[model samples]
Target: MYKDVNNGELRKGDVGKSITVAGWVSRRRDHGNLIFIDLRDRSGLLQVVFNPKISSSAHKNAQMLRGEWVIQVSGDVVQRIKGSENPDLPTGDIELSADKLVVISRSKTPPFEVDDDLNIDDLTRLKYRFIDLRRPKMQALLKLRHDVTRTIWNYLSNQGFIQVETPILIKSTPEGARDYLVPSRLHKGQFYALPQSPQQLKQMLMVSGVERYFQIAHCFRDEDLRADRQPEHTQLDLEMSFVHQEDVVNLVEALFSTIVKEVRPTNSLSEPFIRISYDEAMERFGTDKPDVRFGLELNSITDIVSNLGINVFNKTLESGGTIRSLVLPGCGYFVRKQTDELIELAKSNGGKGLVFISIDNEINSIEKLSYENYRSPIKKLLSVEAVKSISNVTNAKPGDLIVIVADDYKVANNVLSNLRTEMGKRLKLYDTSEFSFVWVDNFPLFEWDDKESAWSAMHHVFSAPKQEDLEYLETDPGKVRAELYDLVCNGHEIGSGSIRIHDRRTQTRVFNVIGYTKKDIDERFRHLLDAFDYGAPPHGGMGLGLDRLIMILGGEDNIREVIAFPKTQAASDPLFDAPSFLGKSQIDELGILFKPTD
Candidate 1:
């Protein structure tokens, strides 16, 4: 048997070459007189022909070959008879004239097909991920993910960034999300938490004179799942000394732009991405991470709608609420059911209800509601002046639909933002290949925590407050903006970072603002606090979610597709059946006990 005949190296001119190929049977076609098997390896696919006239013994064995069977074949490469060519396959012009065949291993019927076009449940595919990896699409995604990682590593290394390892078992500090804690056997009742990111460590490396540091870090967070979120994921964590927020941002932008050009040349990126302030993004798009690819921007109509005497609007304004509207071009054709569905979606995001007006009808006043016979229930509540004001504010024209939300500013904006995304999807308003990247700066240093009745760090306690806002930190922490920035692409927050607090006084003050007492701060972060005693350099960095970044690059919805052995939504690994029970002896050694409940 030939030892090596990969799919890519085959050519029609190599007809006289003797070859050996080992692969899984992609497909098996049996004619009465002849048998053909499509063999597939990671590289690609090759066709093998078994003619009984040439070798009856080989033909008999080939007849038993089923889909996905592991086999080895010794063959003579030959050009296919002109009519027998398969124009679809890469190696279609030639076929393997088999002399011998050996079944290396047999496979049972798979739970699902391993072909690229098969539609199967994700659970089933994840359960049998090994087989799923054999599919062309999955294989390509994994390879692409590898290439992306390699390119990033090479680029960073060339740029003098040193890859450093950070500890996985770290002391947990408050960071907005629940940490995945690891039980410490030696310390009885004490635990070490898995890092949500290498936020502190990378900064410490800079403090220790590492100058520049980066790690393709694995982070764990005990959080609920979403399409882009996972309990355990990876990030390209990096930090640099002697830099400001702009320096870090420029470095990241250059890296990503280079990656895009190298990995996905077909996709285009705007030169020098647009910059948007957090307030401006929220004002125009109703979201801080606005997808700038589309133009259905949100507009305020509080003054016009509040004076119209519409109960929803007047009540909202009376209660210190705001009214905002988004005009969907050509959405006036939506039926009653679609509008009702949109209202429900908005309500779920904390809105009271959605009030929509179809501008397609020419009737201009509440009194002419019966004349135009609009589909919305609020048609009779608005005055002619209010209608005209709304149209002018939103630039609404014939065949336009204006969806308005009246609630507290935060609630109204959030609800309308989500609804805008939904409408974009339903109406096919977004371009899949379009990447609209922007920097979201001026993030609030601390957000008011209603539950705790205190101020909490919006990004983290170590993030530096902007110099302009530093004066307000002691007086009004709520109004202070941090030197934090988020890399947002097409409405997805891909990465976040900030200028770190290098001075001990500022750092301690930040903790105090978050209601951390001196004792509590020392107890939780004594090492970090102590490290700052030495002369620490000014440094800053960002962590990009590798899984989410790959998902975006590959145009995949789920992060699992880009991850090789990703856990399900429940945070369970089906392949290894991890998080399994340990034996009593092992548990006893760790001094652990589970109280079984009746």
Candidate 2:
């Protein structure tokens, strides 16, 4: 055994007991005849002292110790002097009196200190991730992740959910993002693609009569990367048989509610988890995944500003566009430069421009308001009555700035959603410590793909349309609502799911609606469609992003912090140097060829 007890297991109660401990030397200080070192293991740190009076050999050995040198020590646990105890540590009240020391392994100076929380660069940290993981902060995050997963497994197991493992390689059918395809060595010119999600297999599990199934599933996507996204990821993939829309939602709600209470007791969670329709979420917050912890809700001001002789508003209304405004409190004093930046922000988010009406002075009533009370470029074009109407609709106060966007409904809401969240961040509007979970349901079953001149499944082809909306499948697909739902937290979409089309008829109809030909359906989704024939029960479920969930719980802004090893924003791994060129022999073995570069 490496030690009788872990370094962190030492305590005042264990004083005077002889024990052995092994760990990396966190820090070492040499006093004249004595040496002190903090030994760190997976559990935590413990202070070990080497004195000539205790053992001259051990004292001499400790003198050669340096940071990150792995060593094992036989010592007696002793209580520290009253004034010398470190209250910051749990084992601070006690110290180890070392009588012997063994240098198990030596280490060179690390690229960065593990004991200090320095602002290290991402490349350096990732390249030297082995050392970075030694930090206490990183260790705690790893433990928190473990606790969360363990809690999930226990909770779901108790709920009669069976743990199932699915295949890593799956058939390549369009989910949304491109797939990371693996070339088949034995089969000429054929390939196997990594699973984006176990979407079909879990549904197949339901067909196979696994009443309830779950997996900590691995998924891959060859797509652009961001702080919250990666080339590969994990999700809590689950499906339930004999279930409806609410049954799946209720199960996920209960699972997350239990996780938050057990793993993150300090963070405040709203009870009953607020539910909103897809339309309501997009109208009020401008996004289906809204951070409801703070309110800067979007309000439609087209009715108020219509026919006011303002060319911007009138022209927008004339072209079937909508005008929406959101109030930014206390930003009424923004200078020309600040407002111009906001205009650029709007333009970047696919809006023509933004119109700002800054309320400069206080007014008790609409009758008391005047032209001079508000500041806008178009103030000369508006009467005091028009301004008051706009203000009343958006509930703008004396010190609020009303930012209005005039564009098509889709572009207008998209722009405002970005602006709302950006301003919320700059103004520190929402409490970072609070988590707001919302369930947005009733998404459209199909969206028109202008480029393809055809209809596309809004969530996925497997999603079932509402029973009442089936009539519109052939006549008016846009009006058909699907049984899709999403689990969102603090403006990040954690997962999406829906009641699946379990029968072949509806499944075939969805395939046809999405522009898939009969031959295409028989070729691509033949296995799933064929399985539905044998006896697929009414089933539905969700796949929650495991990394995003942990990132939120750990109070981290980037998902990379929660992930042990993650690719850079450009989807490159610095440590392994992946995406490298393959040798000629290897490429030829896989029957692959590459074009010559200039």
In order, what lDDT does every prediction score? Answer: 0.86, 0.91
460-542 per-residue lDDT for model 1 (tens digits): 88899988898998899989998899998878888999999998899999998988888898888888878888989999999
TM-score of each predicted structure versus truth? 0.96, 0.98
Write down the lDDT that model 1 would get: 0.86
The lowest-lDDT stretch of 10 consecutive residues in candidate 2 is 360-369
- Candidate 2: which stretches are off by over 4 Å? 364-367
lDDT of 1 at 335: 84
For model 2, what is the C-alpha lDDT against the true structure?
Answer: 0.91
Q: Tens-digit lDDT track for model 2 on 436-533? A: 89999999999888898999988888899999999999989999999999999999999999999999999988887887888898888899989999
Looking at candidate 1, what is the lDDT of residue 485?
91
